[model samples]
Target: MSTPDNNWEDHWRETLADHKASPPSTMDWGGMEELLEAKVAPLSPIKAPISSLEGKTLKLPGLPWPVWAIAIALVLALGYWLGSHTALGVSQEMNTIPKKTSLADALTPPADTIFDTLFSVGANGELTEEIISIERAIVNRTTAQKSPEINTSLPAGKSPSPSTPVNLNREKLKAGSNDIAPSTTPAVLLSEAKAPTTSPEFFTGIRRPDTPSSAPGLSYDLSSKPTVRPNRGGYVRPLKTLSPPTDRELLEQRIKALSLSEKLVITPLRYKNGHFPAYRPRN
Candidate 1:
């Protein structure tokens, strides 16, 4: 009995046997031959005309050398003119501005007066005598003003008592005036003389004497040594003395062992004949 697959194979064989391969009638072989001839033909060589530029160098188009020289000169002249003009303007501005004077210069006496005072011997004595007289006048005026106030403040029936007399020594005043000179005024000297003087410690910093005293009988031995108590706890075990090898040391030892083993072993060479054998590579 013929199966469907066998029947299909037999029908395909008969159909293939009857099939014929014939050329197409519409094909133009003559046109195709002409196109092939055209493609195969060689092209003609192009010829360039020889000119003066063939041997000579081509220059860039720009201004002439003389024109360039003139332009550079003009630029330099303009720069010079600008620089001189700016410098002149700055000088004029500086000259037009006024010079400033300091407070010390304005307050200072004339050079002539300074020269006269420095050279003249009588000037010093006269200045000292004048200062002393001024101080005396000030002291007398202050005392007089205070006396009236004190009397007015007291009861009408009660007589105002005479106040202590102010002592003014010429030698002491002269010494003090000579020592301080122009730095201290007469009023300041009088004030300093009137104010009571005291030790620096009285007004500033901590007062150590004012602190309260310690209790009478309680005494402390600062020089005595401190007592130490005995340890009552159990004895502590000491730490292990042996330390394990680190990873780096282990790896180094492993590498050393591997190197020694590699030296002992004889490995076969890839190309014992000193030349690679030719073989087809697998795709």
Candidate 2:
């Protein structure tokens, strides 16, 4: 607004310096530059761009190819094991087998107390003591009858009078003794009691006779041809033409495979006296 005069430049600079604020922490140019250069980033050799791993031969510092393969295989195996555990989960066992509950066990009423058992109930919903008195009387009668002193002393007199005595014949006493009662029985009674009561029912067990047997056997479709080959000719077949196996035969073959492959211990044939000489292969 005014012309340059009276050395105003130096005064303006002094006034701005007096009013100007100090640098803030974030805006400190010297500190920021120091930090950027020393602490934040240090200049080094420029690294080359990393190449793709697909085509390159992977050279792990010391580990061999099989080690990597083993590691991968272990990882895969672990993954498979984990996957299988997750997929199948734990096997359900019959740990809690269903208890066979009977109708008697399920529907039965709880056992009653002695008071409930003996007491009499009227239709008018009143509890009567009549049943209690009757029970008490029965108990008293039982107690009285069981006592020996009361029973023995009931009739008073120790000896019977001549008028009350009853006489027994000595001959009748000897003839009717306990051990030898002498009852008559026929000999044929035993055989008649043991005779078989049944006639016969067909289809009993695995072997049925053409003519009916005294005891029946098991049943099958007897009309069908035999699956088992008990041959008319002897066992004279070529090695190649050996019978085509059934599934059961295959299972038997699978079972025998372990034994067939197994080599017997090469033991020399020993006799009672000495070692026996080797026989001819054809024999």
C-alpha RMSD by candidate, in order: 36.1, 39.8
lDDT of 1 by residue, 80-196 (tens): 999999999999999998665875465444333311101001211222111112112111121111100011333345422212122322232222223444225332233334332
Residue lDDT tens for model 2, 1-283 = 4456845877887899889686576658877787777866567767555544546786768888999899999999999999888666443334445444785454433333121112222223222221112112121111111100001111434422212222222122221122422121111121123222343332222211211111222111112332332322333232323222222233345435534433233344565246676666885
Lowest summed lDDT window (length 10), candidate 1: 142-151
Highest-TM-score candidate: 1
After TM-score superposition, what is the CA distance of residue 274 in candidate 2 from its true location, in Å? Answer: 99
TM-score of 1: 0.18
How well does candidate 1 score on lDDT at residue 163? 27
In model 1, which regions exceed 4 Å deviation?
A: 1-70, 89-152, 156-283
Q: Please report, as a residue range, the 10-residue window in candidate 2 with the lowest summed lDDT.
A: 142-151
lDDT of 1 at 280: 62
